[model samples]
Target: MDESYFFKLKSVAKDRLSPNGEVAFFLGILLYSGALLGICFFAIYYAVDFKKTSELFKGLFIGSGVMIILLIILFCLCVLFEKMVFKIQKIIGVVTVLYTIFIAYFPFFYFFIYLA
Candidate 1:
């Protein structure tokens, strides 16, 4: 009876901590993917102009295209390497947090420095 009680308690704790590891992993990937898309959109938006800025336009187009390609590749990799992601869940969590911070900060910082 005591052993069964302990097992139930352990499972409850585990569920509380993670709930569902796969869901968490995919949610993290989704967030990063959205951020990458946002970056690509901003890059393209800022890069284009109706003036004679051929070089700048070309560079921005190429950079933004490359970023989109990279984002697709990352999505594919995450889908293919589910086991690996689960193994490195902690590292993924840390990186996701840092990336989120950068994504959130960039626009705010830009507006503060340039617009304000």
Candidate 2:
């Protein structure tokens, strides 16, 4: 019913924040932001090039391909830090559950925000 009721990923992420874990989380945020920015970059770069449904499909596939690559890269980094992650697994568990709840809230969240 309210957008303010939306869950924050940061809150759970914060509870798990350790010096090293913070670094890894920071890295995730960094990579996440970078990947997002890179997507925006290419999306704009090809804005004029996608003139048809076929081109739009090509663009979508390319964007998805890039996202998959980024996810695998991030996954490897997470594995590299797996030893540290064990300590934070409980926190991550809560984060995951909260994230699932957050997904459900997102439509209401965005709809209200859009109205605002």
Candidate 3:
């Protein structure tokens, strides 16, 4: 069986470039941390209504906090497993990409459904 072109390119890059996996991993950690924090802030901001509290907003606030804590735990584990830097980077990258898609999709979806 023959390897795909992308596989060949990646192999060549990995061998010759000696990519800084740790840097990638740390960058991903930073991004995920920032995103979680932002979401937490937004959720809490929306939920802060003593007179009228929405169950959905309260749930979002709690969920965001939990996610942030979980990410912190994962960050600690990534720091401990420094040798598995590439795997950590890939995990974070995939997560960030998915989150980005969701972030982008919601607003456009609302706009299309309500405005258009």
Candidate 4:
């Protein structure tokens, strides 16, 4: 009885995680990844300009806001593409999620490479 109960709970958890994972993966790829890349670029600009710290923070804030809007637009495009072009939402969604993960983490992976 106890083992069966635990198995049922585990299955339910997995079922719930699937949809949640889709959203989590989407936001992680779109928003957080874009913010990190934007911040890196902004830091380089700051280093070159020697501008006010406040300006840097302001730019970062504005850039993040812009990225959020762009993220929404891109997400809508993905949905529209799946609906109109592919007609296989899960396949396209999974592909986009995987690509986003690659885009988000590729820089970190590349950083570990050493020249021969």
- Among residues 3 or more apart in sequence or in different chains, the pairs in candidate 3 whose N, CA or C atoms overlap within 3 Å are none
lDDT of each: 0.54, 0.49, 0.54, 0.55
lDDT of 3 by residue, 22-105 (tens): 445445655755664565455435554322545554464465456546656666676677666565667766655654554445
lDDT of 1 by residue, 1-116 (tens): 78999999898777744524444644565566457556644654576432434555446446544644554564466567766656766765665565455555544543332221
Local error of candidate 2 at residue 62 (angstroms): 29
- lDDT per residue (tens digit) for residues 11-64 in model 2: 555565443554455455445545554554455446634343355445554654
For model 4, give the 10-residue run with minimal summed lDDT.
Answer: 107-116
Steric clash pairs (candidate 4): none
Instruction: Report the lDDT tens digits of candidate 4 across residue range 1-116.
Output: 68999998998877654444554566666666666656655654555332433554545446545655666665676555544423444664765665675666545632322110
Q: Model 1 off-target regions past 4 Å? A: 1-75, 110-116
Which candidate tops lDDT? 4
- Score residue 47 of candidate 4 by CA lDDT: 54
Candidate whose TM-score is highest = 3
Query: What TM-score would every model get versus the actual structure?
Result: 0.42, 0.33, 0.45, 0.41
Report each candidate's C-alpha RMSD, comma-separated, in the order given: 6.2, 14.1, 7.0, 9.4
